[model samples]
Structure formats: structure tokens, C-alpha cells
Target: MTVKTTLSFTDRHHRFLTDKVGQGVFASQSAAVAAALEQMIRDEEERELTLGAMADEIRARLDTPRADYVPGENAFATARARLQAAREA
Candidate 1:
């Protein structure tokens, strides 16, 4: 299903689309625009999936028992000691 509508583009954008069409990169301006839109949709979907995964990870981390986790100060001191050792080596 295709909907016909008028679209406005800057001169630069028009030239880009025209050049792509001339180079056989796309069948027409509409095809180029559709491809761009499809890419945007994919990017948005990927972003949503990444955010959901990050949220799930945060939730899992929050559910961990406090006693089972290292204190932040201890963690930082250990990291600093490792860094100093690496620098000296």
C-alpha cells in the first residue's frame, strides 16, 4: 500500500535524492525516502530494545542481596591499586 503526498525538501536534499536516483542507488525519489524512513524505523526499534535490556539488567542488579555485593569504596580502592600496579609495571 502506497500513499501519494507532496513532500518538501531543501535544494541540497533534492540534489542528493536526484543524484542517488541517477546513480541507480534508488529507483526513484520515493524509494530513497522510503529507504531512509525504513532505516529510521529500524534504528528506533533497536533503541527501544536496547533500553529495555538495560532496564532489565538494572532491575536484576537491584535485586541482588546487599551483603553479596562489594562496597563502592572497596571496589574503587581495588581498582586504584590495580591501576597503580599496572602503571608501575
Candidate 2:
């Protein structure tokens, strides 16, 4: 059998986890903590996707041309310079 270690949380969050366990959403503190971590990971992933989409919308508003899309350090200047250089090349 595998022995497990315990993790501690802040007072309010601890009370929240304890309440969830008490309410039978989870069998124990470990289960409740696992559920909380999973929820946090899910929320983080969603936030990342939302932020990415917002950035894409801003980029679209900038109306950057396809051939001018240079994904380099200092994006704005680089893309413009790259397109200009490519035109002369």
C-alpha cells in the first residue's frame, strides 16, 4: 500500500475544503484538495485561452498583413522591417 502525505491550506481555504468534505462532495480532505487543484488548473487553462484570444483580437485590429507577420523579438518593428527588407530583397 502507498502511504500519503498531507498538505495544509490557509485558514479560510481550509475551512472551505473542510466544508466540502463535510457536505460529502469528497470523501476526505485529500479528495477535496485534489478537486480544488483540478478546478484551479481548469480555470488557469481557460484564462490562458481567453488571454490568447484577446491578444489575437488586438493583433487583428492592428491589421497586420500576412507576409509582414514576423514573430521575432520586438514584434512591431521587426515585422515591419522584415517586410520592407523582403520587398527590397
Candidate 3:
């Protein structure tokens, strides 16, 4: 089911939508708006997921004992060398 509602856009945004529809990117203004909104939703969800993962990593690192951890300099160099090897492969 779809709900119909009125939305207002600035002149520039309206023109951009109109041009996209005219160029056959979308069949109508509604389609263009829907596509834009869907992409925005996807992007925001991805951002939230990324931030959540980063928080989990930080928490895990903080919980680890200092004795169990490697030095930052050695860890960074090892990671960089691995990445370079992967790219070359």
C-alpha cells in the first residue's frame, strides 16, 4: 500500500527533479522523489551500522588488558604491510 501526501521543495530542488524526470531517469516526479528518499534511507542505515560496528570495536579494545595488547606502532606497520601485499596480489 502507498500513502499519498503533499511535499514542498525549493525551486532548485524542484527543477532538479523535473530535469531528472525529463531525462528519463524517472517516469514522474513521484518516482524521482521516491528514489531519492529510498537512497537517503539506505545511506542513513549504512551510516548507523558503520557507527555501531566502530563503537563495538572501541569497547572491545578498551576492555582488553594492556598486557594482552600489541604496541600501536608495530600493529600499524603490520597492518599496512598486509594491505600492501593484498593490493599487489
Candidate 4:
């Protein structure tokens, strides 16, 4: 399969990519970019999945109220102190 597009690259990056391709590391500049873009897409998909899982966890936390909050202590400081204490223990 073959694809073509008018893609732009900065001078420095262009030189760098071209050099790698010229060294026989890649069959062509397009091949190098396509390989990089394929990896980027895979990474982005993984990131999106991880973020979605985190968002779900956050929503669950929001629905569950903690009974440990002490009066007069700000939420952040209390949470940080509890977490640090747990880590030290």
C-alpha cells in the first residue's frame, strides 16, 4: 500500500530525518515518517485508554464520600498528609 500527502517539516527535523533515511535506516523519508506516525498513533491510543480509566476512577471517588476529613483542615492538605503518612508507614 502507498499513500502520499504534502507534509511540512522544520529544516532541522527534515535534515535529521533525511540523514537517518540516507544511512539506510529507512527505505525512504516517507517510510521513516510513516513508521513514526504509526508508533505515535499506538501511543496515543494507549494514553487515551489510560486516561479514560483514570477518569472512571475519579468519578467513582467523587461518588464515595470519605469519613476521615477533619474539621478546619483544607481538603488538599488533609489528603496529602494522609497519603504521606501511609507511604511512611
Candidate 5:
């Protein structure tokens, strides 16, 4: 089920879409708009999922005991040394 709606674009945006359609990038203006809207929906969904995962990770970390934590700098130093060794090899 698809909903039909009218959209107004700025002159610049209209020209950009027109040029894209002229170049055979899309079958029609509707196709170009539909493609862009689809991409936007996907991007927003991904952003939401990422934020949810980050929130879950933060909550899990907050529940962990501070005594079990290692200094971040120590981890970074270890990773940096590994990269240097890899480069030398």
C-alpha cells in the first residue's frame, strides 16, 4: 500500500532533480523522489537502531563494577604498540 502526496521543491532542488532525470539517472521524477525517500527511511532506521544499541551498551557498562574496569589509556597503548609492530613486520 503506497500513499500519494504532492511535494514542492525549491528552484535549486527542482533543477537538480530535473538534471538527474534528463541524464537518465531515473525513469521519471517520481522514481527519483521515491528512491530518495527510500534511502532516507533506511538511513533514519539505521540511526535509530544504532542509538538503541549504544543505549543498551551504556546501561550494561553502568551496571558493571568499577573495580573490573581497566584504564582506557592502557588499552589504547596496547593497540598502538600492536599497530606499530604490524607496520614493522
Candidate 6:
């Protein structure tokens, strides 16, 4: 189903869409706008998925026992030593 609606764009945006259509990147201005909207929808969906995964990771870390957690200083020291070794090699 196709719905007809009026949309306003800044001069810059209009020029970009017009250029894309002229270059045959899209069939028309409407097609270019639709493709852009589709890309935006995909980006938003990907962002939501990444946020959810991060939240799950945070929850898992929080559930870990204190004894299993590494001290921040010790972790940083180990990382720095590893980095130094890698640089020397």
C-alpha cells in the first residue's frame, strides 16, 4: 500500500535527493526518500538490539559473585604489562 503525503526538506537535502535521482541511484525523489527512511529504520533497529545486548551483559556482570570479580587496579596493571610486552615484541 502506498500513501501520499507532502514533505518539506531543506535546500541541502533537496539537492542531495535530486542529485541521487539524477545519477540513477534511485528511480525518483520519492524513491530516494523512501530508501533513506528504510536505512534510518534499520539503523534504529540495530541500535535497539545493541542496547539490549549491553543491558544483558550488565545484568550478567552484576549477578557474578564478588569473589569472581577482578580488582580494577590489578586488571589495569595486567593490561598495561601486556601492552608493553606487545610493543617490545
Question: Relative to the true structure, how large is the alpha-carbon lDDT of every model?
Answer: 0.97, 0.85, 0.95, 0.88, 0.94, 0.95
Give the lowest summed-lDDT range of ten residues in model 5. 70-79
Residue-level lDDT tens digits of model 5 in 1-89: 87888999999989999999999999988899999999999999999999999999999999999898978888689789999999999
**Cα error of candidate 6 at position 62, Å:** 0.8
Please give each candidate's TM-score: 0.79, 0.57, 0.79, 0.64, 0.82, 0.88
Q: All predictions: root-mean-square deviation over Cα?
A: 2.5, 13.2, 3.6, 5.1, 2.1, 1.5
| Candidate structures ordered by TM-score, highest first | 6, 5, 1, 3, 4, 2
- The digit string of per-residue lDDT tens for model 4 on 1-89 reads 67668989999989989999989999988889989999999999999999999999999878776675345557478789999999999
What ranges in model 4 sit over 4 Å off?
65-89
How many clashes does each candidate structure show, in the order listed?
Answer: 0, 0, 0, 0, 0, 0
Clash pairs of candidate 2? none
Q: What is the TM-score of candidate 1?
A: 0.79
Q: What is the lDDT of residue 71 in candidate 4?
A: 54
TM-score (C-alpha) between model 3 and the true structure: 0.79
In model 2, the runs with Cα more than 4 Å from the true position are: 1-3, 64-89
* Number of the predicted model whose lDDT against the real structure is largest: 1
Which scores higher on lDDT, 3 or 4? 3
Model 4, C-alpha of 19: deviation from truth (Å): 1.1
Query: In model 6, what are the clashing residue pairs, if there are any?
Result: none
Model 6 error, position 30 (Å): 0.7
Candidate 3 vs candidate 4, TM-score winner: 3
lDDT of 1 by residue, 1-89 (tens): 88999999999999999999999999999999999999999999999999999999999999999889987788799779999999999
Worst 10 residues of 1 by lDDT: 70-79
Q: Which candidate is the best by TM-score?
A: 6
